[model samples]
Target: MPTPVIDIDSLTKVYPRQIGQPARRSLDDLRLRIGENEIFGFLGQNGAGKTTTIKILCSLLRPTKGAASVCGHDVRTRAARSCIGYLPENPYFYEYLTPRETIDFYGRLQGLDKATRAREWDALSERLDLRGIGAQRIRGFSKGMRQRLGFAVALVGDPPVLILDEPMSGLDPLGRRMIRELILSLRAAGKTIFFSSHVLGDVEQICDRVGILVEGRLRTQGRIDELLNRRNEQVELVVSGLSAETADALARDALHARRSEAGLHLTTADAAAANAMARAALSEGGQIVEFTPIRESLEAYFVKEQAS
Candidate 1:
């Protein structure tokens, strides 16, 4: 396997308490590896220590035990920090700076040459749709605009990896779509993306793999389809024109059966049972309207693991 762009092993973090309160472990023996050029989604409920893990990886917070490395360099060292572009959940900027100036400032901090800075700025402005308001001051920018700028600043150095915290938070549908496209585009350019999000739909849509964290523990991590398919398979059959007797018989044997305005909905545990149900419906002079396998969704899997 190719070397992991982000590697974490036996990582733990504890927040010191004042007075009588006990120290809280924000992360506990967490282990995760993100491969090169892959889009990996980090998922968890509120206060599940998602932010703590990201902070540790970004060198914003030190782990009490264990180690984390980015691009083969220890996160605690300047070399590893230079390999990542980090966009915090709530990105702050100098109110007086324009989007242009903001990118320039970050580029300077990264010690990028003026020529390199200008080239990256132009490319980012066009890619992130920042051309219209690139000169607008930060104070008056809308949330979505600020988000676009945040992305531009993070990309100024063109780091090989991106670590974004809640990149889609507080955005309208359009804004969310824009960010989603940007993430996909980055992956296409062979940059590793590690991000956290509560929006399961976006995760399902864009992520190559996912890791679920619950209460500071790594609950599960794998390809989304593999995790979802580990559960038992089910099939749904929709039939119409079934006689009352046939409908009653189906309800007695099916996992679930219900009547709706469109048709009778029947759920079975396997394809064989579903085929039998369809044949039975047809023998009773019913018309088959739809037959669909009910695959487990990412949200269902996440919720089940979190609850466990």
Candidate 2:
């Protein structure tokens, strides 16, 4: 196993009771271990405590109970802070400052010298497509523009880990793609990434592992294929040389069946049923054309869990 870089153990956060309300727990014994250079996707519906967990990891909020650490250092310490580059759900900026000024400002805060800051700006501006708008004030920039600049700001310190909350919130398709690819490249460059997003499709595309948070608790966490394998997998068996009547007979127990120009298509709840149908078709002098498994998608799983 790779060395653990981000660790959370029995992490719990409870909101204090208000005048008219009882105490509410935002995170309950949430535990997760993310290894070095891993892209861990945090998934949850709205108000599921995803942000609360992220805030605790970023040291923006104290967990009512339990602990969280970055690179083996407590989140409350300077060492842990130094290991992370954070991008909040809504990235705020000095409206009067240009992208160039903003990038340099953050670099300075991270203790970079003039020469180093300039080099950092050059690389980030080019990568984030901020070069053209470098001199333009951010006050009038679009949401996507600010998001790109915010990501550039996060990289100002070249931290070893990135903790992003809704990093793709305001980006267009191209911008989202850019950010997604940038994240993958960052992991390739040895950065550990932990992010929470409602964009299940994007997470499904890039994340090595994912944790689903539902109502302040982690329902599950594991590799995409492994997690999905626990659920029933649908299989489609296609066969040729079978008449409509024969196809109907063979696929009588199938979830759905159809005979098209392509072939006789039999969709079953599991591979075993598909195999049975294929055997029946083959025994009837039919030629097996294909068997395809349609795995449960992250979005489907996420929706079901949230509703559950």
Candidate 3:
């Protein structure tokens, strides 16, 4: 079997509080296995322990229970620290240092020789749009610029695995697109990427697999196809003359049926049953309009999961 780049088993973390209150638990029985060369999206609402999990995986925070290994090395072991790269949601840079200087400084910390650092800076500066800003102090750079620099720092070590937290949070539309392309490029280069994002659209576009977390518990994890298969079946329709009564009845069947300018839209767990209902609507003098089946999208799945 191909070795898992990340093997986390029954991981748990809890914070102790004062005498009168209960101990706050951040994670409980969290388990996951991420393969090499996979762009895995770690998904969750805010305060779902995504950051805690990343911290533990990077060995920055010791787990309160269980264990995890990254790239065949114990996370607690110092040697394993060199096998991974981390990009925080808010990347901090020395406002006084230029982009090139920032990269060179981190490159040296990663044990790169002066000559090697020079070569890396040349390549990364151009790739990351730092050619102009490379010599300018970071204090004046935009949020997008700062994020790119952070990514460059993460790449300095040439680690096998990457852990990024909300990497696209502060970026613009174009900057977001740039980061997405960069991630796809990294995946093509056979690098493992583990990232958390509230941007479900991007996650759906770039990830090979995804894990959904809610209330610090893993609600679901799998490939896109598999997750869709396991979710409530939905069919979308563009019906012409959907009567108000029929629409109300369809909406009451634990299905989402809405009237749009194009037509009526219906989403349900049972496609056949929904079709039967549509027939019933027709019998009741409801005009059967355009019946286009709308497949459930990743965003819909996310919304359902969150609501659940």
Candidate 4:
């Protein structure tokens, strides 16, 4: 088996108890792995320890127990830090610097040659749609614009792995789409991405695998389809021309039923029942308008997990 780019094992973190306060455990015995070149999404409610886990992975906070590694190097070492690019939950920058200057500063810190920094800046600026505002002072940039710049800084080093916290927090719909495309593009270039977000839809759209953290504990983790498919599938049938009595009869085997101007909508968990409902509707001089089978959505599954 190919080695994982990120390996986290039995990780835990606890904040020290203060006067008149309890010692808060920010992470439990959590364990996870992200394979090379994969896009992994971390999800959770606010203060669910998602940020704490990310901070540990970035070496900003040390785990009270267990270990984490990036590119086979311990997260506490400089070697591991060099192999990963990190964007904190709220990235700050010099207010007087322009995008070009900002990226250049990061490039210099990474020990990139001037020529290499120039080339990377041009390429990243174009890829991130920052050409127009590349020379504008950071103080003048909007929140979304700043978020884009943060991505550029994180990517400037061309590291094999990226750790981003709430990368889409300040983005609009269009900005979100742009970030999605950029992330996919990075994956295509063989970069591993680990990011946290509250935008479940975006995570559902792109992540190859996802892990949900709840109250400092890992509630669940797995492939998106596998997790969602665990729930029973449901089918919906829409039929027209059915009398109220016929509709009621059809709904007998259905999980739910509703009336619409065009038809009676019936939903059943059993595919056989859905088919039977359609046949009964046709027999009653009704016209079948639509039949749809829908698996549980990620949001639905996430909400259920959160409740549990």
Candidate closest to the true structure, highest lDDT: 1
lDDT of each: 0.92, 0.90, 0.85, 0.89
- Candidate 2 segments whose C-alpha is farther than 4 A from its true place: 19-22, 230-232, 239-241, 253-255, 259-263, 269-291
Tell me model 3's lDDT, rounded to 2 decimals.
0.85
**lDDT, residue 34, model 4:** 93
Error of 3 at 205 (Å): 1.0
lDDT of 3 by residue, 156-268 (tens): 86788999999989788999999999999988888999999999889989999999988888999999878877444566554556677777776677367676777667765
lDDT, residue 128, model 4: 79
Give candidate 4 regions above 4 Å deviation: 243-246, 283-285
- Looking at model 1, residue 223 earns an lDDT score of 94
Q: Model 4 over residues 105-153: C-alpha lDDT tens digits?
A: 9999898999999998999898877899988899977878888888889
Q: What is the TM-score of each candidate against the true structure?
A: 0.93, 0.90, 0.81, 0.93
| Local accuracy of candidate 1 as per-residue lDDT tens digits, 197-258 | 99899999999999999989999999998889845689999999988988999988999988
Best of the two (2, 3) by TM-score: 2
Query: Residue 98's C-alpha lDDT in candidate 2?
Result: 95
Give the least accurate 10-residue stretch of model 2, judged by summed lDDT.
Answer: 242-251
Which segments of model 1 are wrong by more than 4 Å?
A: 19-21
Clashes per model (N, Cα, C within 3 A): 0, 0, 1, 0
